[model samples]
Target: MAFTQQEIKTGFKAIFSNFGFVLLWLGQLTSQLADRIFVYVLMIVVYQSTHSNLGVSLPLLAFGIPSVLVAPWAGVLVDRFNRKGILITADIIRGLLILLIVPIISKSLLWIFLVSLLIYTAAQFFAPAETSSIPELVEKHNLIIANSLFMITWMASSIFGLGLGAPIVNFFAEKKTLAISAFLYFVSAGAIFLIPLKPQEPAKKKTHVLKDFLMGFEFVRRNQVVRYALLKLFVAASAIAALSLLAISYASQILGIGEKNFGYLIIVVGAGMLLGMLTLEKLRHYFKMSSMVIMSFLLSGAVLIGLAHTGDLRVALFLIFLLGVGNIYITSTIQTILQRKIPRPIRGRVFGVQNMLVNSAFTLPVLFFGFLADLGGILFSISILGWLVLLTGFAGIFLPKFRTV
Candidate 1:
């Protein structure tokens, strides 16, 4: 299973040489940067508007619920349609939705939430399409590096975008910030057009797509390793979701830091993520997937427990950095493993199921934690999520069956 230096070099050469992948990277960079900016900006605005952490989380609830609800349908569309077309169409619609919110955000918070929800609904389609298209864009052996880069830029964008949010918001002021967000999506659409990717799907039978859809679930049910990896991934997703929602209040209320200062906390987390991926890129050939999987979950949980108790800003930031490291390790490993294991025809649907569960992990927990944080206070709620993560890690270790996974 180990890769040679030559193999790694060739993989890097293969992806970089492909013009289509270069375009895909540009599309991801702009769109994801905008994604971080828009989501965090909107959350901050909502918090400022209502002065309620629950209200802050409501928008995310809106974003996540629709994505989860529509994931299955979106998967079907991704498998059936031209992935490039879906990417273009999604970008256009998401941009328009961001544009529509510009003027109304100052006047109506409700309008902001509604428009954002629709924007994210469109984004769910774009995600699976892009993921499923990757196998077609590069050689099979290069997928680890491909998935690794995908995860890295995603974090790098978040680092730059989140760290830059205050400056961007202050410079553009709120009105132009919305415009900038919309502009990025449109630019992303144009970039996507440059990619020549075409995902090969199964021939249509008059029978029904629901059968094909059910088959994705059947595949999951039958494959023990995928099932284990996916469930482990789901646990990681849930912890991050809860932690992300908590960070806003943690920084603002407890840390006594303002928006800009709080974003730095997130920036540290992003930095850790970048480093984690870099470490993975260098060492992936040397480790078993189970080792990466188990260690990431354990490290994430341990860091969260420390982060929950530490009131010192410096200590909290350090823990957050480790948390980010653990987060990326879990995510990157899951994606690489899944991409390698799944067949191309049903890949979209399976990835779609992943979207559904992960978003559900996000939305439903935020819904509960928003209320919980509001009632019990932020630190207490965050500790619970931390413990839940730790418990999952321990369960993974004790479960003899997971060793095979």
Candidate 2:
């Protein structure tokens, strides 16, 4: 039988009216690709120079800590300033900071790391602005689709960037590679300028910025659902980071692949994430939020555990693929839930707090996992975390709110 005309019309409407979404997705693709490339480039460069996991991991630490420390203030600005302007300014600042490397790469490692630190701090402001701007660009009913598109680009960019980074960095000098990343940031800044919508004006009251920042904390404290959602996200982000910290070891030893293969392995995971995000809307119609959330966690937790048991490279790749899908769905759904639950005026702050949780969740585990990998081997350490993730999900299943959601 032919599909109904109403179904076709609804699909067409969704595509035609979502011009902002198209721009957002394209911008996200380019920016995230550059961002991921920067991460891998830093890691590879540091490892080649210092040959220590700590050296490769230092930039991640540098990036994460400032976001955690400055999130409250960053939240306030995200709310008070024009978010689109914040986004554009952040891109320009970060691009300029990265370009500082072109002339200084040979000076000292400390100088390069400091530039990375500045870029990370800039990211603190950029994240909240970008995340909070999404709901304003699309219809309420399109939140799932919008989130799906965002998640898809996020994973694709990571996989693509990392996959491309190894070859590019191998071919180009370090300074030249950094220059490519800078070019990408300039392109992203240009896109932000083209966004047609304007940011909201600041409130008329001349409130202190610190006091205004505290209001975000107070507002989140009063919202139970947002708090619960953030907690779940914390657990998920931590587990994912723990898993990622072990990937280099896993690639080198378990998979019989070299450093370059880690990038390719991540691409497999990204493929799974893209598939999951694209299908999320359809899945939501069949499963309630509660079911999807629980299943997402369970699947991710299970895959990580299974990844440990497999010695076969193909089996391991499949497990990682499943983990990617599970993680993206869980994380994207949480963001969509926040967009629905929080008021727009405070959305920036809410998301800023959420960003803090994400940074904290991912960062806190790095040292512990790095040490664990040093002591117990990467597989065992990651296996232990996989179990914790599973237990956390099971416990959440019994929460009254978890069931209701």
Candidate 3:
């Protein structure tokens, strides 16, 4: 039977009406919340024990490094294995790893650190499975809705989890907080169980390691639109990382706020994200992905530049919200565009490459920007990066393909 446009829309609506989507979303929400809580708690534990910023950042690097290193391989596996089974196994392993840390709470920090690293590595596997699984389960027209829902839950959970973690930790013992996080992981695993979908078949022809690894890169290279979209993504993600880390410092020093007040900044960003995601479907019809991306970059840069000069906390909060809105719109749109362009077979690898590039871009700014902050004040460093973002955005306008989109 031939498919009609009306059938496509109705089919999506039917999918949303089911109990499975509800359960899956609940599981996603719980897992994301737990992920944020664990990170915040880890930072707290490290800072409390070592009293060193560098020491606290160690766990983050450990987690991020593995994910970046293994993303391509993981992506290939996602395409090769049962995506549902992979996620289920990953969540279970990660949960068990978190639980393992409970006993070592009173032990040396190294032990807990090691367990956290293992849990993060497990998560790297789960991430590609989860990303690739969504497209298989939902209708093509509903991809945007699914992705936006994921992002909404993600941003909200991140803000609230960080906001609540410290207070909960303060009220309860460290071991108890860790236990709570462990439970959340199990809950997330249960949620993965609710997603009703099978995995993709392994590639028909046996492939070599190098060829499999380059799958995502080659796909993007072949698709002109996808390549530009990814480059734009890389640029935007790097600028975001630089600004976000600086905002943490901005809260502590420039705004003279306590650690808890950082939650307010997060909330502002989350609120903006929620708004952007909710309206994105309508926006997508009017504004092309490239247009939205360029506008977001330009506006986000301008906001950062304004923020660099601002001394008032309220104003900084406002700019952050604006930044959040622009960021969400751009990111969600690009993801949707990519989802449409890339076939299901290679989506995992392409997304994995996108993830790797983004992380690589984000990593570079931190190294140099962190040093710049030490030499110059945080404000000046932020201002410099903001200017660079503005330049990139302006240069984007000159690119024929991006402008046409």
Candidate 4:
């Protein structure tokens, strides 16, 4: 359903008045900030010690591998257990894990990878619980605004966290940086503790773990809304991942800028994301959620195609900014739809599936596009991706299931 102007105004008021959502948002903000900082610090510590790119890649593998292997089961656990308790415990465990890294920083790379693995494994559980909590905390009408706020904070944290990481590490050093990240996790735990979620009733009949895991995939297979939403999210994620790999080449060849200056383009994209979040409610007044998603896909595809042909830095920056706006529209709209449509009992499991697809997008799409860039040239690869996205958007217009959402 599309939101009216009055509903949009009321949604903003609803979000701020709801204290439970405020606390959830706070917890999310702090936890995400800590996560970004932890990653930055990990890269620095690993590079300083081993002075090898492979050493850095190993830690990233530790982070990404859990989403593939452990996330589905983690969702099962989230469904069976008390979500609030799960969230708090996950934060505390991750906090302690960050602290554990300090004493082992100088020991061995193997030990560091082990700790990183544990930390991110805990994160797999934290993620599904956190996403599943939102529908519980806010009115259905407010879901769009609430998600906008969350995504806004997420982008802000990425920009500020990475931007500040170097200076923070330079001043405080690596050990102190770890301490600060740990403290933020504790703060997140504290915020989550204040949210007034009622206890989950115990399941009357326990299902087998394998059955429960398969149930999530089965539901997605049968539910067209969820299936398509996830597909759009995967495509969006893949586009972002491919762009991340290609941004360096785009900067160097197309814009005549050095590779290091690619960050400026990213910052512009972040700014556009912030703009998109702030303006999303107004946009919703004019378009259905499905229309927004379709338009965003088309927008992103067109921007990429434009970038492939453009030589002017200003025009490239504008296109990249538009891509960021399209990205937020696609993600935030579909997330709200999932929250509204999915039954509460199975919410975590579906979102766990989502996490798996999104993380997989980062790895597989990056690898494929990196190869494509090498073999076919950066512009050629980008044009191919753009055509795929554009065609998908056009296909969505003709498909009945895509619009039913």
| Best TM-score among the predictions, by candidate number | 1
Per-prediction TM-score, please? 0.91, 0.86, 0.85, 0.78
Q: Tell me which residue pairs clash in candidate 3.
A: none
Residue 270, model 4: Cα distance from true site in angstroms: 1.8
Off by over 4 Å in 4: 2-20, 41-60, 100-114, 134-148, 155-160, 163-178, 196-198, 245-264, 284-291, 305-313, 336-345, 370-388, 394-405
Candidate 1 lDDT at 209 equals 72
Sort order, TM-score high to low? 1, 2, 3, 4
Q: For candidate 2, give the lDDT of residue 306.
A: 88
What is model 1's C-alpha RMSD? 2.4
* Model 4 TM-score, 2 decimals: 0.78
lDDT tens digits by residue: candidate 2, 98-181: 888668666667887888888888888876677677777877766655665566667677677977776787788667888898
RMSD of 2: 3.6
Model 3 segments beyond 4 Å from truth? 1-13, 47-56, 102-113, 139-144, 170-175, 194-204, 282-286, 399-405
lDDT string, candidate 4, 145-242, tens digits: 78767777877886557545666777898889989999999999999999999877888998898998888798899998899888888888888767
| TM-score, candidate number 3 | 0.85
For every model shown, the clashing-pair count is 0, 1, 0, 0
Residue 306 shift from truth in candidate 2, angstroms: 2.3
lDDT digits (tens) for residues 1-405 of candidate 1: 557789779888889998988789889999988887887788778888877768878677767888778888887867677889999999999888888887787788877878888888888888888877777887777887787678778768967787767678877777688788889999999989988875576666654778867777888889888898788787887776776677778997778887545667878888898788769866677777777877788888888878778789889888888988888888887777887899966776777787787788768788777778889988878877788888777776888767555
